[model samples]
Target chain A: MSDAPREIDALIEMMARLPGLGPRSARRAVLYLIQKRSVLMAPLAQAMADVARTVRECANCGNIGTSDLCAICSSEKRATGEICVVEDVADLWAMERAGAFRGRYHVLGGTLSALDAVGPEELRIPRLIVRIAEENVTEVILALNATVDGQTTAHYIAEALEGTGVRITSLAQGVPIGGELDYLDDGTIGAALKARKSF
Target chain B: MSDAPREIDALIEMMARLPGLGPRSARRAVLYLIQKRSVLMAPLAQAMADVARTVRECANCGNIGTSDLCAICSSEKRATGEICVVEDVADLWAMERAGAFRGRYHVLGGTLSALDAVGPEELRIPRLIVRIAEENVTEVILALNATVDGQTTAHYIAEALEGTGVRITSLAQGVPIGGELDYLDDGTIGAALKARKSF
Candidate 1:
C-alpha cells in the first residue's frame, strides 16, 4: 500500500535502478524531490531531458559529449601526441579531476573478461590503435585498473601495439598520497617496497 | 578539465544536488545513465516530466497526488472517524507501508520549532481542528517524530484539542520489535524500562 501517487511511485522505482541508489534511498530521494518540486525536481527533469536530447559519445575517442568529438578530443591545446587509455568514462573523469594529464583519453568502455566474453573488439581497442597511427601518437599510457581483468587487458593491449613504434607505459603503483602506513594493504606495501625509488 | 560534454556535465551537477548523491556518485550515476540512455535514462526523464506535469498536492490532506483530493482522503472506506497526523509526506508513506491504520492522514508539513520560527499557522493544525468538527472525528493520532520539535508540536496540538471532545493519543515509546537491547541508546533503554509490560 504505497502512499505516494502512481507517478511518484514509478519515479521512485526508476530512480532505484540508478547506480548507488537502493529502493529505500530512492523512496527518500523521490519524497525529497516532491517536497522541492518547484526548485530542484523541475530543473532536474528539464536537465535530464536536455541531456538525453543532446548528449552523445565522442565518435573518435568514445568519450561522452554533446558533439561528435568530446571537448578534450576536439581541443587544439589538448592534442598532445599521447593517449591515455582507461577502462571507462568514470576513470577518465577521475584523471581529468587530477588535472595532471594534458593528453587526450581513450575510454575502453570496459576491460576484457573471458567469463563475460568481452574481447578487444568489443571495447574501443581497435579504435584506439587506429587513433594512435592517425594522430601520430608517441606514447600509449595504459591507465587501466589494478584488477586482474584490467591487468590482463593492459598486457593484451601492450602486445597488440608491439612494433607499432608507440612507447607503451602504465601508471606506476606505489603508496598513495596522504596514505597511512598502518592502514596500507599488504599488496600496496609490497609494491611500494619493490618499486622503492631513491629519495 | 572535464572529459564529459557541457550538457552532460550540467546533468551531473544537477544530479549531485539530489539529497543522497554527492559529486562523485553523481558523476558515476550520469555515466551509467548515458550508457543506458535508450533503456533507462530516457524513460527516467520521461517519468520525471510526467510526474512534474501531473502531480499536485491534495488540497484536503496535503498529500501529493494527481488530483485535488488524494486517494486516501477521497476514499469513503478511509473516512473511519480517525485522522493520523504526521509531520511530512514521508512519514505518511511510512505509515501506509505499515498497513496498520485504516483512517486517513493529515500532513503537517513540518513540526513546530521556536528556534526556526515555525509556528502552528505554518503547519496544518487549524485545518486539523476544522476536520475534527466537520467529519465528527473520534480519534486524532499524533504520529510525529520523537524529536524535541515533534513532541512540542504534539503537545501543542493536544492542548488545542482539549475542549474539542475528540480523543487524542500519540504513538507509544518502547523497545522496537526487532531492536537489540545491547545496541539500544541510553534514552531508548530508559524509555523501554519505564514502559515495561507484563507477559
Candidate 2:
C-alpha cells in the first residue's frame, strides 16, 4: 500500500506480523526506522539477528536464554524445591520483574484448549512432571492465569501430580492493588471476600 | 527487568523507542519475535539491514528511496507541471493510496514551526522554488495538514512564490467522507458550509 522499495515493504510486512503491530503502525515504524537508520535501525537489526542466532529455549524449563539452560534454571541460588508453573515465558518475566519469587519456573507455553486441540503433550506438561522427580521439588505453585483455559490446565496438572507426594498450591485470588472495589468484577469481589483473613 | 539475555533486552529497549510502543509492549513484541525466530524474526532482521544500507532520501523531493530519486520523482508518467507538496513522506504515501493525484509530489519533511525553531530553510521550500523554475512547473498544490503550523508553512510558501506566475492552490476543506455532522468541530462545519458547491 506504499511506494516504498521492496525491501522496505517486506520489512513493514514482517513487522506487521508482530503481535501488537498492524499494517498502518508497521508502516509508521518502518518510516521511523528509515529516518533513524544509524542510531536505531542498524542496531535493532543487528540485535535481532544476534538474538535469532544465539537465543535458545531452556532445556530444563521453557524460558528463553543463550544456552541450553536459562539463567534461572542454571543459577544455583534459585530454590530447587519450589517450582512456579506459568502459562508463558512472558508471565515468567512478569513474575521475575516483581522480584518476589526466588524459585525457578516451568513455562507451559500455553494453556490447554480443547477447542484448539492443545493437550498436555502439546504443552511442556510432560517435561514439568519429569522435572518434579528429577529436581526433587517439594512444592508446585500454579501461577497460571485466571481464565477458563488456564484454570483447566491448572486442574489437570494438579490431578496428574496428585500421587507424587508434592504439595500443590495456586496464587491467591483477590482484588488487585490500586484496583477500586466498585470497578472490580463480581467474581473478583466474591473471591476477595472469601479469601479475606483477620487483621 | 527480565532475566532474558542482554541481546533480547537491547532489542526490547530499541523497540520501546518506537512511536506507539511502551516498555511492556516492547517486551511482548520481543518475546513474540523470539518465539517465531525462524519464520519471522530472521527475515525481519535481514529486511531492516537491507533497507538501512540501501534506502536514501530523494534529492529533489525528500522522499525515501533506494536511489537519489524517489519513485514519484523518477516516474516519466507523473505530470511534472503539477507538484503536490506534503509535510512528510507518510502524507505522500497517504495521497498515493488515494490514487487520485496523477502529478508529482514534493515532501517538505516538516511544517514550519517557530516554537520548535523550524523555518523554510530547514524544510524543502528553497528546493521547491528552484524546481518551479528548473522544471517549468505551472501549479503548486499545498496538500499540507489542516493544523496551524501546516497552514503557516503553506502561507509562507505561497508568499515566497509570489510573481513566479505559477498557479498556487491548496486542498479544499470539507466534511470528510462518512463523517457525522454532530461529531465535527465548528471550524470544519463552517468551512464545509462556506465551500458548499452548487449541486
Candidate 3:
C-alpha cells in the first residue's frame, strides 16, 4: 500500500533521473544516506550543495570552474601555440594524467552526429576556429573517440582548416597494446587488420 | 618529468578520496570531464555547485535539504504511531520503494561497532529515545542490516527500551521469492531453513 511519505517520493523522483540510477537504485541510495546521516549522507549533501553554488563554465575552453574563465585559460604558461582538441572533458583529463602533452586543450563538447542531428554549430567548433587564429596555434591533435561520428567530425575539422596550414594529427588505431584478440569483436578485428603496422 | 599543472594534481587528490573512486578511476573520470567540457563536464560542475549552495542538514531528522528541515520531518501528517528504525538512509529508501510501511522513520546513522570504537552515543540512538516519548509512538520496527554488528545493536536497543511498551518486529528471513537456490548464499539458506514454516 502507499507507504512512502510525499517528500520521500519527490526525492526519489529526482534521484531516478540521474544517469545510472533507476527508481529502485534511487530508493537504496536515499536509504543509505538516511542511515549514514552523520558520515556519508551529510557530507555528500554538503559537497553537492557547495558544488552547485560555486561551479561554472569556462568561457574560453568550455571547462568547468568556479570563475567565468577557467584556470587553464587564465594561466599564462598554458597559452602555448599548440592546442589539443578533444571530444570530451574526460579525454582532456586523461592527457593531463599522462603528463605528456605540454600544450593546453580545446574541448569539442561532442562529435558531430547525423543520426542525432548534431552539427558543427551545435558543438564548440566555431569557438575552436576562433581560438586557432587568435591563439596562433600551430599543431592541433584530433583526440576524438574511435567511433564513426568522431572520425567524421575530425575529417570535417581537418578539411575546414586546409588553408590555415596548422598540422593536424590523430591518435593511432590498431590492436590495443593490452587487448586480447579473443575478446575483440569482428568489427574491431577488421579495423585492426586494416591498420596493421610494418613493425 | 613534471608534466601536469599543479592545480591538476590538487584536483586529482580530491577526486581519489571519493567513495568507489581510486586514483586510477579518478584519473579516468577527470579526463572524461575535461574532454566533454561543454556537453558533460561544464553541466556536471554547475550542478554540483548549485546543489552545494542550496543543501543543508535537516534540523529535526538530519535528512539533507535545501532548507532547515527535510520535507519528511516538516510534514505533520507523517507523524503516525509507527516509526521504522533503520541503520542507514539507503535502507529507509528501499522500504519506501517497496511501499510497505506508512509511518515516519528513525535513521540510526550506523550500527554499534566496537572495532571502530563507534557507540550508541555516536549514533542517533539518543534522538530516537527522545522521539519515542515525545511523539507518542506505539511501534518501533528494527530494519537494520544482517551483519553481526547490526543484530547486536538491535538487541541492545530492544533491551534499553524494555519499559517503553513499543511493539518491535523485523523483516522475515527466508528464500526470497523467485530467488534460485544455486544463486543463494549459505547464510541466506541457513536463515530460510531456521525460519521455515509448516508447509
Candidate 4:
C-alpha cells in the first residue's frame, strides 16, 4: 500500500511478476520509470507494446522472434546440418552469446518433468525429430542443463532419435573456465578428471 | 549480444538501467514477459503508458500523483497542521504504508549534498518553507533518513525555520520492532540505548 496512483500500482504489481523482481524492487523500478517518464518509461511501454503485438514463437525452432521463423532458422548460412537442443529460449540466447555455434537451435520450452506430468508432446521433442530429416541434420547436440530432469529429457531425445541415423552428442561435462579445482564440487571434479584431455 | 529481436534488445537495455536489475536479470525478465505476453506484459505496458501520460509531481509537496495536488494535499481532513517532512516520495509512501501518520507529508525530493552540489534551492525546501505559513502548520516533523545527508538537511531545515515560531521535531531513533540486539550495529545499539524508554 504505497498509495501510488492506480496505474502506477498496477504497473508495479505486473513488474513484480517478472522472474527476477519482487514487490520491493518492483516499486523501486516503477518509481524510477515515473521519474524518467519521457526518456525511459514511455519508450519502454512502446517497446513492450510492440513486442507483445509482433513477437511470436518461431514456428520451426520454438525460439522467440518477430516472424514465423527465427533469425537463426531463416538464415541460410546457419543451415550447417547441426541442431543444438536447449531446454529454454534463455539457453538458446546463451549459446548465441557464446558465438561458438553457427547452427540453428531447438527450444524445448522446458525439461521432461515426470512429477509435473510433462511428456514428449508437452515439449518440442516431436518437432525436433521432424527437423532432423527435413533439414538433413548431420548432428544433434543436446545442450540441456545438468539437472536430473534435464538428463532425463536428454536420454529420452537420444532414444527417440536412435533410428534417425543423425549423430547424437551431449555437451562436455567439465570444470568451467577459470574454475578452481579446490572449489569444484566432487561430481564435477570427478567428471573433469575422467574426461581429462591431452595438453 | 543476446541475438534477440532489436526491439527486445532495446527493451532489455532500458530495463537494465532500472535500480536493482542488471543485464542478465533484465534478459530473464524480458523472456518472462514474452512468455506471459497476454496475461501480464500487455497489461503492464498499458499501465506504464497510462501512468506516464497522467502521472505528475504534486506541485505542493513533490509527491507523485495524477493531479496538481496529491491526494493528501487535496484532502481537507489531512490538513492537521502537522507536516511530516521526508527526503523522497518513497519515504512518504513508506510512512503511508505504516499507517501511523494522520497528517500530510512534504517530500524534499532529496537531501542537501555537498559532494553532489545539491542545496536547499535544488530541492523542495523553499516550497516546504512557504507551506508552513500558508497551511497554518503548527509542527514540522523531520522524517528523513538517518544518513549524514538526511540529518544535515534536517538540521538545515530546522535552522531555516528559526523565526517561523513553529515547533520542529524529528522521528525517534531506537531499535526496530523485530531487530535483535546481537545483530544490531554499534551505532544503532548506541542510539537505541540513548533513546531507551521505560518498559
* TM-score, every prediction: 0.97, 0.99, 0.67, 0.98
Tens digits of per-residue lDDT for model 1, A1-199: 3568778888999999989999888988888877778887888888888888888888999888888988889899996699999999899989988889999999999999989999889998999889988999999999999889999999999999999999999999989999998999999899999999998
Candidate 1, superposed: residue stretches over 4 Å from native: B1-3
Which residue runs of candidate 3 sit more than 4 Å off their true CA positions?
A: A1-81, A126-138, A175-199, B1-84, B96-99, B102-106, B123-140, B159-168, B178-182
lDDT tens per residue, model 2, A1-199: 6867778888888989887899999999999999999999999999999999999999989999999999999999999999999999999988998999999999999999989999999889999999999999999999999999999999999999999999999999999999999999999999999999998
> Please, what are the lDDT tens digits per residue for candidate 2 over residues B28-86?
99999999999998988998999999999999999999999988889999999999999
Best candidate (score: TM-score): 2
Give the Cα RMSD of candidate 4. 1.0
Predicted structure 3: lDDT: 0.70
The alpha-carbon lDDT assigned to residue A74 of candidate 2 equals 93
TM-score of 4: 0.98
Q: Per-residue lDDT tens digits of candidate 4, residues B58-135?
A: 998888999999888898778569999998888998999998999989998899998999999988888988999898
Question: What CAPRI grade goes to candidate 1?
Answer: medium
- Model 4, A1-199: lDDT tens digits are 5788777788888888888889999999999888899999999999999999999999998999999988889998886599999999999999998989998899999988878889999898999999998999999999999988899999999999998999999999999999999999999999998999999
What lDDT score is found at residue A125 in candidate 2? 91
B-chain TM-scores per prediction: 0.96, 0.98, 0.89, 0.97
